[model samples]
Target: MTPTIPTRQPCPPGACICERERLVEIQGADLRILYLTRQEEKRLLDRLESLSSLSDLEHMQRRMFEQLGLRVTIVPSLNEVRSMRGIGINIDELPGLCRKTRQAIPAAIRRGLEKRPEIAYELLNANDLLRDA
Candidate 1:
């Protein structure tokens, strides 16, 4: 019996060859993930609505992208993440990421406190805030 080889599909019409190349390059970069808090998401949405100047909007987007530990040049904004998803990258894995992070939090917190006691204080304060609410 012979094994079948999968065929490569031709690029879609009107799509830039450079974009496919860019996606190939991005797949190799260190995966930087962001799980934004509700407050941060609200702030970004507000900024998205309020920014009228192109330069200002671009600046804010770059800042937000960097804050999320993503490459600003490769991913200029959250909107670009959605665009990447449309192109077939499996980036919508936040829920899975969150589940894994939650499972590892105890060990992470222990290591973090040993390295920096400030993290312990911050964690307690965060817990208190959540508990109070």
Candidate 2:
């Protein structure tokens, strides 16, 4: 008996090569990870810290999903106890999350998130966010 080696199908025409590469890299992995450069992370953190309303967070979430295929949701903790589907992190927990990962989530932003837990979104890492099923 002969064992078969798995093969990846070729990407279709006009498909995003970068995205294809990312998918290939994560094949059979337990987690889908997105990596960001330090500058990118800083910019994202700055934007997150500046979000003034739920609408802003919603817009950012939509853009992230569209551009990076990352599903993120931000809502008031008082109205929703937990996310039924995707990963959920409390707004007040961003600092601790960052600490566990040894990422640079500024103290000012942590303070802000603590003060306004409603504006919280999951903070994964300085350069990447991981999603594991």
Quick one: best TM-score, which candidate?
2
TM-score of each: 0.29, 0.39
The residue ranges of model 1 lying beyond 4 angstroms of the native Cα positions read: 1-35, 71-133
Alpha carbon lDDT of each predicted model: 0.36, 0.42
Candidate 2, which segments miss by more than 4 Å at Cα?
Answer: 1-35, 75-133
With a 3 Å backbone cut-off (N, CA, C), the pairs that clash in candidate 1 are none
RMSD of each: 18.9, 15.7
For residues 1-133, could you state the per-residue lDDT of candidate 1 as single tens digits? 9985332232454542313334335645432333344345445545544544435534754675465543222122222222212211112222112333323323332333344544333433443522443
Top candidate, metric lDDT: 2
- Tens-digit per-residue lDDT, 19-106, candidate 2: 4444546657422223333445567667766767546656866775564444554333333334321223333321112232223334
